[model samples]
Target chain A: MSEHTTLSDLEAAIDNTFATDAQQASVDVVEPGIVTAVETLSMQQALNRALAEVLEENPKALVLGEDVGLLGGVFRITDGLQKQFGEDRVFDTPLAESGILGMSVGLAMAGYHPIPEVQFDGFAYPAINQIVCQVGRMNYRSRGTMPMPITLRVPSFGGIRAPEHHGESLESLFAHVPGLKVVSPSSPNEAYHLLKHAATRPDPVIFMEPKSRYWQKGPVDTSADGYSPEGSRIVREGKHLTLVAWGAMVARCLQVAELAAEDGIDVEVLDLRWLKPIDAEGLAASVAKTRRAVVVHEAPLTSGLGAEVAALITERCFGTLRAPVERVTGFDVPYPSGDLEDEYVPNIDRILFGIQRVLENRRG
Target chain B: MAEISFPLPDLGEGLIEATVLEWLVAEGEQVERNHPLVEVETTKSAVELPSPQAGKVVKIYGGPGDTIKVGDPLIVFEVPDDTAGIVGTVPKEEAPRRRVRLTAALDDED
Candidate 1:
């Protein structure tokens, strides 16, 4: 053998090159759902488009939240909406989370589609009782006689380094409560369509907004069908490791996939947009091919959606997995302050660590 | 004097305090009823508060970045004597008041 083929020669060439394993994997392919030339719009703008479109389409749809009237909401998501629709239709409410949601349940019972913005993730805790007891169970309580067609737009997640309650991933809390449909949009595109879908759905939806990703630009076709909020869209596909995430974490996982490519790991990223009725079949199929799974989210690790997903994966794809399912999530402590949050959140490194752990188990 | 009390409106989602993002009306500025008078930033979104009375803005209670509580006076207005007579008696075009609850701020948690 030539000296150029020596072990040291191979080590010298490979040691300096940092390529991710995902980069080496096959390109993700799926039926391109729908595409419309969408402009670069902020999260608020996309939401406005969706709301405006829905209101125009459905006369029964009403937008309510704190300061949604002439103030147009705190984030201005409802800006100009009242002006266009009139104050009688789009109005503000007394500041009470439970009241906002409870009134919405009442209005929905009266055949109006009440869309209330909880304003912030942590702020929604007070309304948990209304959501769990009333909004969640209203349908079953009515025995199909009434439909609680209400949508709660909750702006959540971290990365802005905001205060404690400002950046919380509380999806698991709502997901655990039956009868509540949870849908989190990872980009502007999803924000527009999913909101439209959620507005029309016959059940109440906990629409989680990744507050930090409110400005991230993506294609939002107000005219296209790809942005269905009711269905989960597979963002990427691979046959080695499945990275299932939602909201802002989906973008984080995509970044992790780029880093993972250098390590020769093929990761399939699934955007679990609708978390309540999770796209279990889609997730199961991906895990089956990869034989490994890593569920990632920003919520605290204890009883987080990751745990639920891991359980679901184990239950559905246990035979296909060569390694036990893994999870990458935040610590169990309260969402740390902005400065300490970086240490608490699950980043690309954490995701890679989870993938490595799962892959290592398979190797052994 | 039209005691234009800009009570702190509910900032929504239990947001008690909001940063005064901007002042749409300055002191002594003539504002029409229902015109925007101030901008406040809460955790949820930024909202432009409408003026409750159409008159000269007498004073602003809070400056930018100050967090005001719900029901706290936000601004005052100098109304014409005719309008002054009906200040608290009649609910003359009462602007919506957002409800604010006493809750521990995020930092207050141990």
Candidate 2:
């Protein structure tokens, strides 16, 4: 009786410093194996885990690529696939990039959910003909009467110290193509769910696996509970600036966000999973709060998707912008040698520099 | 004579075409199972394709620098009909494999 009477007093004594669930709801799981619950894996391992789970859940899901079946891929993302799924289901393809994409187009037309690997970003150039003209446009051309439920996987971005054209961030090229949905997961968790989502999408999707972040591990809910590619994830909410990025750049932006935190700069981070139909509304809202923004990517600064994002932000939130949008991106020159990739790829300091520029503009 | 045709296998990371860099065996040359048949370079890396069935090479479909797609006829071997003891010896499945399509129910839309 005494304790019951003292309950209100104890409640009143509580600090109430910790935030409650009222702030944000728990994560919603779309599919059972959509996310990894425990130990995080490298981006590559995360993709492999997701593919294994997806193939297990859906017998129709097939993985086709060069060296992916037996050699486990040059990056080893598809290691042991041939043995587990048998040579028939997870075998290697010919060296023709266009043939791979064209065959995938036909496979999707024939009702196959094909996930074809382009091997590398530079190599993906050859497949662009098939992807841009046929694979990307087939479904729209048929006006939904036909769907190319194919996922074109390419490991893109610089910073892995790859030689020559191996590390080019050619996202702009894919983004320019209609009927193709481009996406990149910046971390292991996003990689797991995004790949699953890409595999399941009805239209052809260009899944650019960030080869640079292939080995970085993070939290993943492998229990299959995760978000969809259609949604833009808010990594951090800020009242000062909105930092929008994807794939490897997202990770760099997050680091910059951490640095900004040290300087009392509250910056919101937006991870755009689906690059084609981006979460424009959500991004505008973030910019409206911050009144400033910085768009970043590994692709060249000239016509990268960041340019499109900058345009969209200004169009949607013109009055809200405290300053013009800034972009931190790769240079226009060809991807340099492995030794010079560090300078080519945008990093924490570069992103921070962008934030500083935007903040200064806001002050001015 | 039993005909052993080597239809190109999926090289894994979804390669569709490969360039034949070198032929390890000449037409009419005898080869053993798992012997390196040809060196093919795809988009990612260069690899040596192994002979599935041990026999005499009757024909080579792709020459050096010639590009070929998966499921294309790689080689035609005059395999002996004496024994079908080869484990991985798959009869030429098809000239070009029909696309392996995933059913609609399994198609996961975003």
Candidate 3:
């Protein structure tokens, strides 16, 4: 900083930094294979443990959000963290998503890793300015000198019969932004590891926590390696068709896959965990094997993340695909409140019907 | 120059209150941080509570079997103005007896 500098010189330096970065390998993920000693944990407990570990493992990391400290979040995803990590490392913040995220940007620029929560998916709207203009752009905007090591948590998606704005899906919006890595973990196991992995990366990660799945219990292998930032995960193996999904929809797809099996229909379920950087290769591979695909998401169908996945599938698996990629998504309308949510969210029967559509539309 | 109050912190496992089992340090006795100040029995088990900072004990509230709430003042102390009985002390002409913000800064780990 003391050296004399010009705009051209800074641009040259920035170009050099990016060149090195492009050649640099992506984040190294430990492949903890066959972890057997796992504890049964709800998605909430797993997320809590992940944050606790982040604070404990990195002295530079902290957690901030509304009711995150004493109340432990509306979903209690951060329960007992304040006591375990102390108020300094884990504390509540004012009920302003923009302020919380703005503080995170400042803190990250100051060399602190901050995990700020938006409380609910809809709550992120107020913070869109900070998220898009600052958090996602700081690194590139600063010529790679000011990478934001932030994990912005958003308790997302539908199903617990909550009111409007409480059950919104914003994955499409987050993934569309440049420089933001969007990830949504569909289960307790994925939630535990993906969160830990997201917190460690030197970029901002939009961590979409499926709210309805928070209380569902599943085995979490702590010692297991976290999911790689590279691609989607194949949760079930089948040869007939692949059900591409993430978040709460993954569970619903799995159930539909089971039901599809009884009707002499074998299906594969692929959880597209990482929304941005869409894991095009993995999607192509899964669809290449199955030859048919149906994407399921909670967002509206018009320009939802499912459309992007469908396009990626078409681009890479066109010849191998026996049918065009189909999407079973929410209708193009505002996410309604409870009492109408059951019809709004894609259910098992709707997904099965979508699967049947793909099965019927044979591309000879 | 300052009277510092010590509230019973929530011990792990979500215990809200603890009954005084015994007093290990008498009033007016000087004790260092982490020194056993009193023994208390919770619903789970009996455990000794430690002095949070180095100070002269000015008063000890409650007797044996008396219950103390999680945030209730359990003891008070008298400490020098400069030597504030709390973490993250700053030099001030009139320093209030309060714990400073917890931080993870390299030299200021708390």
**Highest lDDT scorer:** 3
Pick the winner on TM-score between candidates 1 and 2. Answer: 1
Candidate ranking under lDDT, highest first, comes to 3, 1, 2
- What does candidate 2's lDDT look like per residue over A1-364, in tens digits? 2656686554533312111223221223336533334875767678888888667666666889877776567676776677788887787999989888888888777667788888888998788788888887665555445667788889887765567767888777887776677888888988888888777667677899877677666888766544555668888887778999988777677767766766767779998877876788888888887788999887888888889999999999998687799998888999888777768887666777777777667331
Cα shift from native, residue A263, model 2 (Å): 2.1
Give the TM-score of chain A, superposed on the true chain A, for all candidates in the order listed. Answer: 0.87, 0.87, 0.90
What lDDT does the true structure give each of the candidates? Answer: 0.75, 0.75, 0.81
TM of each candidate vs. truth = 0.70, 0.69, 0.71
Q: Interface root-mean-square deviation for each candidate?
A: 21.6, 22.5, 27.4
Q: Give lDDT: candidate 3, residue A277.
A: 63
Tell me the tens digit of each residue's lDDT in model 1 across A161-184: 666577788898888886777899
In every candidate, what fraction of the native interface contacts is reproduced?
Answer: 0.00, 0.00, 0.00
What would the TM-score be for candidate 1 when compared with the true structure?
A: 0.70
Residues A1-364, model 3: lDDT tens digits = 4478788887765553222334222433434354456899978789988888778778788999998887567666777788898999888999888899999999988878899998888889999999999987877777767778889999888776666678899999998887788999999999999999888787789999987787678998887655364578899999888999999889888877777766767789999999986889999898888888999999999999988998999999888776688888998999987778878998776777677667767331
